[model samples]
Target: MAERTILVAGTYDTKSEELGYIVEVIRAQGGDVVSMDVSVLGDPPGRVDVGKHAVAAAGGSSIAEAVARGDENSAMQIMARGAAAVALDLYRSGRIHGVIVLGGTMGTDLALDLCAALPVGVPKYVVSTVAFSPLLPPDRLAPDIQMILWAGGLYGLNPVCRASLSQAAGAVLGAARAVEAPVSGRPLIGMTSFGKTVLRYMVTLKPALEARGFDLAVFHATGMGGRAFDALAAQGAFAAVMDFAPQEVSNHLFGGLSAGADRMTGAGRAGVPQIVAPGCYDLVDFVGWQGVPRRLEGRPTHAHNRLLSSAMLDAGERREVARAICAKMAGVRGSVAFVLPSQGCNEWDRPGAELHDAEGLAAFCDEMRAACPANVALHEIDAHINDATFCDTVLRLFDGWLADGTLTRV
Candidate 1:
């Protein structure tokens, strides 16, 4: 194997010793280092292959211009953009295999944008004081980022800081060395799900799709997972999409467990062949141990685990969510259809279940049918989401699309 190059980025003016130590550790772990300086206030402390001036220029400005303005916030933004451009160029040229970034609040903020500029498979590690904070929203976060808490990294080198940095160096380098690009001879199908109980039909659909030479990529409907699914789908990563668990879309609409503001619309916008389903749109998730919301205290609720609590959506909210889904799917250039399971949408939405709201489901179905565009087809199956019959119907429709030239089989 050839020597792998790792990009080490940060405020080299202040964290010079720390950045130097990181580079040394990555080299020890068999990774060649390419240093990038993102400092605006002062000169870098050591040798920087990509200097602040070059980075600033990549971001559409000059270090001199940024420094002359003297606004720390604005200056940091310019550096961040510059760092991202440098990283992107390096990746495109196959010069960098991975990235290890270090910072506090300011550094982490800059690193977030830099990491986002890279594709999903690239290894991105951030050693930050604010690794697990609400300050980093989904829109500002890269789904595959590996963040390590800067336990004792606030100041100069220490035993604690070294411990975290050493592990991070090994992790990023190891990932870069071990990971290879994804290859699928068959068409890739993106599917979304919450849990086995919600979309158990996946067990059946997976085999059927694979038998037809399609590669199935299932994504969990957790906040970050949904974002990754949407972002990747929009990037043309998937040939088709089985967007069953659109609960994240419902969650975002009602300010619940939002995947992000840009959840259900990506695959449609990208014109990917998609089969949409309201798999778990009947409920929105929240942290269970945190106690239920005061407004939803009286609504039907189910605790999937200590961390995940789901609340049933009411009739009005369900109708609105269905309308939103229809609005998103209406503009797809490729074949798109809604596979509505009339018996129930998810496990807890079945008869006698805690989240069973027949009235709400009916309202959702009505609104979807009414709002669904002429280009989009609606298939209402009189079976539960997890039922074999529903899976059969979905597979049959997909087969029909392939046969009719609506979907070109790979």
Candidate 2:
């Protein structure tokens, strides 16, 4: 394999020794290194491949202008923008195969922006004091970035921090060398669903779609999974999308486990044709360990595991969720087909099930029928979402789209 080049980025003015150590480790592993300095006030004792002046300039501001702001946050923001631009340029030019950044809170803040600038599948790692902390919001994180705790290295390099830093350096280099970056080989279809316990359409749809000459990538519709699905969809990664498990949409609206605000709108904005269904429409998942909120105290609840619990929505809330879903699909550039399984949306909500609520399901279906915009084609199926008939209905629409040239083949 060819020698990989890794970008070592951080506030080099303060952490020059530590950053230099990371570079040395990468070089020792037979990998090349490109150093970037994001310092505002001081300069690194050694020169960097990309200096603070160039980084600040790339962000549309000079270091002098950033210093004039007289605030660390403002100055760092400028560096963050410039660093992201420079790093992305390096990746696009095939100069850097992967990136590993070192920082505390301030460095981590900038690291997030820098990593986000790179495309998914490129190796991005952050060795930070705040690694895996709640200080980092889910929305700001790059879909595939990895983080390692910068343990015991808050002030300076030590044996403890060296262990973490060296491992991070090696991991990024190894990942860049081994990664099979996403390639456009077959026509890819992106689908979202829960496991077979709750939703089973993918089991039937996967083999059937493959038989028809397409590859399907199924995304678990939890928080981070939906985020990844949306990220890939926004990149126009799929020929078409099967957005069947959009419970995250309701989760976002009602303060459950959210996959960020821009959950179901990616494929639409990118003009990728999509077929959507509310696979677990009637239930909102919340952190299972927390006490149930006062507003949802009396609703029927089902504990899926130690980490996740679902609460049934009432008839009124169900209608609200239906309206929310319709609102998101109203102005899409691509074609949208909404499949509403009228009998039930999940196994927990079927006849004699723990979350069975006939009245709520009927309300949601009715609201969906009334609220669906002219741009969206609504298909209301009589079967449950987990049933074979529901999968058949989706396949029929998908086949028709492929035949009519609504979806391009690979």
* lDDT of the candidates, in the order given: 0.87, 0.92
Task: Compose the digit string of candidate 2's lDDT tens values, residues 283-350.
Answer: 88888899676667888999999988988889999999989889889999998999999999999888
Model 1 pairs whose backbones collide: none
lDDT of 2 at 191: 98
| Native-referenced Cα lDDT, model 2 | 0.92
- Tally clashes: model 1: 0
Model 1's alpha-carbon lDDT is 0.87
Predicted candidate 1 versus true structure: per-residue lDDT over 205-289, tens digit per residue: 8899989888898999878888889888888889889999988887887667788877887787788888888989888888888
